[model samples]
Target: MNHAIFEKNSLILLIGTLIVVSIGGIVEIAPLFMIQSTIEKVEGMRPYSPLELAGRDIYVREGCYNCHSQMIRSLRDEIERYGHYSLAAESMYDHPFQWGSKRTGPDLARVGGKYSNDWHVEHMRSPRAVVSASIMPGYPFLAQTPLKAEHIEEQMRTLRIVGVPYTDEQIENAQADLLAQVSPEAPGGAEMQKRYPNAVFADSPSKAGVTEEDALVAYLQHLGVSVDFKLYDDKANIR
Candidate 1:
């Protein structure tokens, strides 16, 4: 039998509706808190270094997420095309993860180490030049904009406050590490490597100094290449 009281009163309808919505929300979200295996235990997944973090910030500033996605779904087609499906552990340290919703560009989950740094520079400067059918707009100005790294340490400190695993020494050396990532011959390059073992340095293609383009490229090149898939059974992690 239907409850005539619920239909006859607005306040009763609002309360009943809120109860339904809250139950649905709890059903969806509550399991994550209780489930210990929600995120996989994987090896070789490290947090982003100071320079990579700077590049990630620049990526957000450029609104690259508007067109690109960093995640790869576990469907067979996605695995065939993008190498491996993305892991929750891979982005566990991201304050706001970059698993974008759209794919105007291909999924960037495993784009790291797939192309040379020089190719990335040319493609960013003129996307259509490298991929003739590409409709993406060019970002030539990124190469011209000198990287202002004066506040990089402050940025790292802010990220540390949010649980990004940045150490005191890492935050203190943020500026030098940023410069060292683009200038391998710089005096601090050796120290930077000791701090961030996978950091790669490449000269800016357009300007004399390290530019925003350098940071973005460095960030892109480090994507989806952290976890060593050889150590785990691919089938076990597929989700």
Candidate 2:
């Protein structure tokens, strides 16, 4: 236990340092074992549908998280500006959650149903069209680009392996669901509705083919529709 003895012996000092670090690690990590008990369960939260998932991918690919945060901090200012402060249960199904640290644009945690599809379209095609002062870049190419429907099932399967809870039937019908979300004639709209009860589906644009814009808009529209905040009891959710 002599400090001088340990300091004089480098090997013993290394062992002692390891012991201290191990204890610190255990002290910090042991509380996580009770994480399940700490988390409050909200009933309506569901996994993303295929099209929504695709749109999330596009959002990530385009680095939307750099500007728009999906997390709303539980503070008076954030709560007033962004409706309800974001709940942990709302993003329980997200793999690597979109709790971005910066807000170059606005918080999109509750942007769902806030604007019409046409508005979203116009905004995507030209952000300045909707918000005259918007400095955001336009993504007009998304409107012309066709959706990559071929790999929708594969994406769902990959997400399933990572605790997304995508069922076999859902995975099997992923492409169908993606198509149904964007195109009227596409099969599985009813089944998609049944599978993801509150899932959002946008009307197809005037373009004949399903475009990336359809996927992105559908994803954006479904942002905060899962839980009905009107019935959400804050007291019951307090841990």
The residue pairs in collision within model 1 are none
lDDT assessment of candidate 1 = 0.82
Question: Top model by TM-score, which number?
Answer: 2
- lDDT string for model 2 (144-213, tens) is 8887868878877887888778899888888778878775456778888899887777786765677889
Give one digit per residue, the lDDT tens place, for model 1 in 9-87.
9899999999999999999999988886677877777667766787898899988888999888878788888877788
Count of backbone clashes, every candidate in sequence = 0, 0
Winner by lDDT: 2
Query: 131 in model 1: Cα distance from truth in Å?
Result: 0.5
lDDT of 2: 0.85
